[model samples]
Target chain A: MNIKVAFLAILLMALITYIPRVLPLAIFRKEIKSKYIKSFLQYVPYAVLGSLTFPDILYSTGALTTAVCGTVVALILAYFEKGLVIVALGAIITVYAAGFIL
Target chain B: MKKNFLYGLKRGIPIALGYIPVSFTFGLMAVTGGMPVWMAIFISMSNLTSAGQFAGTYLILHGAGLLEITMTTFVINIRYMLMSLSLTQKLSQDMTLPRRMLIAFGVTDETFTVASMEHGSLSFFYLLGLITGPFIGWSVGTALGAFICSSLPEALSNAMGIALYGMFIAIIIPPAKKSMPVIFIIVISVLVVCILRYIPLFSSISSGFRVIISTIIGAGLGALLFPFEARDNNIQEMRE
Candidate 1:
C-alpha cells in the first residue's frame, strides 16, 4: 500500500470511530428520562462485555483446552475479588501451564 | 482535581496492563501485513479500537478502497455510540462540551466498562486519567511489538493473548454475581453471540452486526424481563 494511502486510511478510520462515540454524547445532552431506556442502558455494559468475552475468549489461546483452563482459573480469581491484573495474570499463567503440561 | 485524576490513573493500571499484549499482537500483525512500524503505531494511537483496527488494517493491506475502510470501521465501532450515550447519563454538568468530546474519543470497550461501573457521576480529569494509562500502554506496546516482532516467542505471546479477555471476565463476574438480572443478561448475551458464531447461517453475519444485535437483544430482554423498581435509588445520578 502507498504510504499516503495507508496514512489516510488510518486517519479516516480514526474519524469514523470518533464520530460514533462523540455524536451520542453531543446530541444526547439531556439526561435520558425514560425508565425503560435507562434500564436498557444499565444493562448494556454487562451484555456488551459478556458477549465480547465468551466464544472469543475460547479462541484466544493456542488451544481450546488451555483456554478453558485459563477461563476457570480466571473465574476463580475473579470470584475471590482479585484485582483485574491478578485475574488476567492468573489466567495467563494457567494457560501457559496447560500448554506445558499438555 | 489532581486527586480525582490520580485515582482514575490508579484504576487504569490494570486496564493498561491488559491492553499491552493485545496491542502488541495488533502491531505484530500490522507489520507482518507489510505495514511499517511507524504506520502501525500511528493506527494504534489514532484508533484505540481492537477489532476495528485489526479489520481496518487487514482491509488496508489488501488494498481496499477508502470507503471500504471507513464503512468497516464504522460498523465495528458503532457500539461505542451506545456506550457513550449511556455514559452521558453519568456525566456531571461541570463536564463541559469540549471535555465530553475529548472523553468520548477515548471510550474504548474497557474504558466504557470501567467508567460506567463507577457509582457516582464522572469527572473530566478522572476520565482523562483513566484514558491516559491505557492510551500509553496501547501506543507503546504497539511500538514494542513492531520493533520486537521477530524476537518474542510464540508461546509467551499466546499466553499473553488471554489477558484482555481475562480482564473482561473480571469486569463482568462481580456484577453478575451480585445481580440476578445481570447474570441473565450476560448468559443470554453470551448465548446469542455463540449461536451467531457457531451456527452456519448466523455465523456468516459480520462480527460487527453480531455484537450490535446481541447487545440490543440481551439488554432489551433484560430490561423487559426485570424492569428496575421505581423505588430503588437510580444509579445514573450526575454530580453537579
Candidate 2:
C-alpha cells in the first residue's frame, strides 16, 4: 500500500468506526422510558459477549482441539467464579500445554 | 471522582492485559503483510478496534479502494452503536456532550462489557480511567509486535489467542450461573451464533453482522421472556 493511500484508508476506517460509537451516545441524551428497551439494553452485554465467544473462541488458537481445551478450562474456571485474570491465564496455559500434548 | 477513577483504572488491568496479545497479533500481521510499522501503530492508536482494524488493514494491503475499506469498517463496527446505545442507559447524569463523545471512543466490546456490569451509573472519570489502560496496552502492544516481528515464539503467541475470549467467559459466565435470564440470553446468543456460523445458507453473512443479529435475537427474546421490574429498570433510583 502506498503511504498516501494507506493514510487515506486508515483515516476513512477510523472515521467510519468512530461514527457508530459516537452517534448513539451523542443522540440519546434522555433516559429511555420503555421497559422493553431497558430490558433489552440490560441484556445486550451478555448477549454480545456470548455471541462473540463461541465459534470465534473455537478458532482463536487455530486448532479445534486446543481451542476446545482452552475453552473448557475457561468455562470451568469461570464457573467456579474465578477472577478475570485467573480464567484468562488458565485458558492460555491450558492451550499452550494442550498444544504440546496434542 | 478521583477515587472512582483509580478504581476504574485498577479494574481495567485485566482488560488491558487481555488486549496485549491480540493487538500484538494485529501488529504482527500488519507488519508481516508489508504494512508500515508506524501505520499499524497509527491504526491501533486511532481506531482502538480489533476486528475492524484487521479487516481494514487486510483490505488496504490488498489495495482495496477507500470506499470498500470504509464500508467494511462500518459494517464491522456497527455493533458498537448497539453497545453505545446500551451504555446511554448507564451514563451518569453529569455526562456532557464532550465527555460522552470521548467516552464513546473507548466503547469496545470488552470495555463496554465491563462497564455495563458495573453496579451503578457510570461517571465520566471512571469511564476515562477504564479506557486509559487498555488504550495504552493496545498501542504499546502493537508497537512491540511491529518492531519485534517473528521474535516471539509461535507457541506462546498462539496460546495467547484464547486470553481475550477467556476474559469474556469470565465476565459473563459467573453472572449467567446466578441468573436464569442471563443464562437464557447467553444460550440463545450462542445458539444463534452457531446457526449462523455453521449453516450453509447463513455463510454469506459477515462475522460482524452475525454478532449484531445474534445479539438482537438473544436480547430481544430475553426482554420478551423476562422483562425487568420497574425497580430494576429505574436508573435514577439505582443511582441514588
Candidate 3:
C-alpha cells in the first residue's frame, strides 16, 4: 500500500469503527424507561462476555487439549472469585505447563 | 475527581496487561506483512480495536479496495452499537455530550465489559482513567513488536492468547454464581454462539455478527423472562 493510500485506509477504518461506538451514546442521552429494555441492558454484559469467551478461548492456544486445560483452570480460579489478573495468569501458566506435558 | 480517575486506572491495570500480548502480535503481523512500523502504530493508536483493525490491515496489505474494507469493518464493529446503547443506561446523569463522545471512542469489548460490570453509574473521569492505561499499553506494545520485528517464544506468546478470555471468565463467573438469571443468560449466549460456530450452515456468519446476535438472544430472553422491577432499573439505587 502506498503511504498516502495506507493513511487514508487507516483513517477510513478508524471512522467506520468509531461510528458504531459513538452513535448510540450520542443519541440516547435520556435513561431508557422501559423495564424490558433496562433488563436487557443489565444482562448485556454477561451475555457479551459469555459469547466472546466460548469456542474462541478453545482455540486460543492453537491446541485443543492445552486450550481445554487452560480453560478449566480459568473456570476453577474464577469460580473461587479470583481477581482478573490471577485468573488470567493462572490460565496462561496452565497453558504454558500443558505445552510441556502434552 | 482525582481519586476516581486513579481508582479507574487501578481497575484498568489487568485489562491493560491483557492487551499487550494481543496488540504485540498485531504489531508483529502488520510490520512483517510489509506495513511500515509507524503505520502499524498509527492503526493501533487510531483504531484501538483488535479484530476490526486486524481485518482492515490485512485487507489493506492485500490491496483490497476501500469499499471492501469499509464493509468488513462495519460488520465486525457493529456489536459496539449494542454495547454503547447498553451503556446509555449506566452513565451518571452528570455525563455531558462532549464527555460521552470522548469516552465512546474508547468503548472496546473489554472496556465495555469492565465498565458495565461496575457496581453503579459510570462517571466521565473514571471512564477516561479506565481507558488510558489500555490505550497506552496497546500503542506501546505495538511499537515494541513493530520495532523488534522478532517473534517472542512460541509457548509464551500462545499462552497469552487465553489472557483476555480468562479475564472475561473472571468477570462473569462470580456474578453468574450469585444470580441464577445471570447464569441463564450466560448459558443462553454460550449455546447460541456454539451453535453458530460449530454448525456448518451458520458458521459463515462473521464473528462480530455472531456476538451481536447471541447477545440479543441471550439478553432479549432475559428481558422477557425476568423483567426488572421499576426500582431495579435505577442502577444507582440498585448499587445503594
Candidate 4:
C-alpha cells in the first residue's frame, strides 16, 4: 500500500470528519437554544435508524422470503422492547433455520 | 477502598458482548481487504469506530490515500460531535471543559443516543461503564476476526451480517409504525440512497462521500420536512 497515499487519505478524511462532528459540539455547547436544532437532534437518531432499516430487507443476499421472515421476527421482538441480545439471537436463529429450509 | 477495575468490567460487559461480533466482522472485512492482523487491531483500538474502521480498511485495500480515509471517516462521524455538544448540555452542567474534551472521543452514535435521553446530570463514571464495554469488545473482536475469520465459513458470515441490518430494523419499525413522518423519512432516505447509487452521476462520488452526503440530505430533509419528535425523555432515560 502507498503509505503517503494512505497518510493523506487519513488526514483529509479526519479533517472532513472532524468538522461536522466538532461543529455541532461547538455550536451546541450552549444550550441548544434554537428549537429547530433541539428538534433536529431529537429525531435525527431515529430518522437515521429508520433510514437504515427500510431497505434492510433488500440489503440481504439470501432468498427474500427467508430474509424477510427473519426481519419480521426481529421487528416483532423489538416491538416488545426486548434488549439487543434477545433481538439478535432471535433473528440469527430464524435466519439460520430459514437458511436450512430454503 | 481503592476504585476497582472490576466495576468497569461489570458495566462494560453488555457493550463488550455487542462488540464481539461487530468487531469480528470489522476484522474479517479488514483481512478480506488485505490488511495485516496487527494493522487491523491497531485501527480498531485507535479509532474505536466500527464503520470508520471498515471504510478505512476498504479504502486502504482499494489503494486509496490517507487524505481520503481521514476525510471520509471524519465526515461520517461528524454526527458524534453534535452528540457531544448536545450531551454537554445534559451533562452535569458543571463538568470541566477538559473532561468534556477528553471524553468526547468516546462520544459514539450509540452512546449519544443512549445518553441524550436520560434525565439529570451526565457522569463520567457511567460513561466509563458504557465506553469500556465496547472498547475491550472491539479490540478483542478485531483480533479475533484477524485470526478466526478464515476458519469461519462465508455462509455464517453472511448470516451474521443479518444482525447489523436487523438491529437497524429493530430500532426503526417500532417508532415508524406509530408515526407517519418517520415512515416518510425512512422511505425518502432509502429511496435517495438507492437513486444515488443507481443514477449515473451520484454513483461517481466516493463511497464515503456517498454516505456522508446521503445522511446530510436525508437527515436535513427529514428535519425540514417531517420534524418528528417524541417526549422520549422517559424512554431514553431508562437506557442510561
Which candidate ranks first by lDDT, i.e. highest?
Answer: 2
TM-score of chain A of each: 0.72, 0.71, 0.72, 0.69
Instruction: Give me the overall lDDT of model 3.
Output: 0.80
Which candidate number maximizes TM-score?
4
i-RMSD of model 4 (Å, 1 decimal)? 4.8
Compose the digit string of candidate 3's lDDT tens values, residues B182-213. 88999999999999988999977766567668
Best by DockQ: 2
Q: List the residue pairs that clash in candidate 2.
A: none
Can you give the lDDT of residue B7 in candidate 4?
A: 52
TM-score of each: 0.64, 0.63, 0.62, 0.66
Q: Evaluate every candidate with DockQ and list the scores.
A: 0.47, 0.51, 0.50, 0.34
Worst 10 residues of 2 chain A by lDDT: A29-38
Candidate 3 stretches with Cα past 4 Å from truth are A1-17, A24-29, B1-44, B47-151, B201-206, B230-240
Of candidate 2 chain B, the 10-residue stretch with the lowest lDDT total is B231-240
Give the candidates in order of DockQ, highest first. 2, 3, 1, 4
Candidate 2 lDDT score at position B66: 73
* Comparing 2 and 4 on TM-score, the stronger one: 4
User: Which 10-residue window of candidate 4 chain B scores lowest in summed lDDT?
Assistant: B231-240
lDDT of 4 by residue, B1-240 (tens): 013334544655776776787677567656644566777787777676644555566667667545556655654454455466667677665456565555565665555665565567667666656577777787998899788756767766566555655556555666667766566666766776667677897767664455445556666776687553443341242121
**Range of the 10 consecutive residues with the lowest summed lDDT in candidate 3 chain B:** B231-240
Looking at model 3, the pairs that clash are none
B6-115 per-residue lDDT for model 2 (tens digits): 98998788889878876775676677666778989999999998757766886686687777677667755776776788789889988999999999888887788789
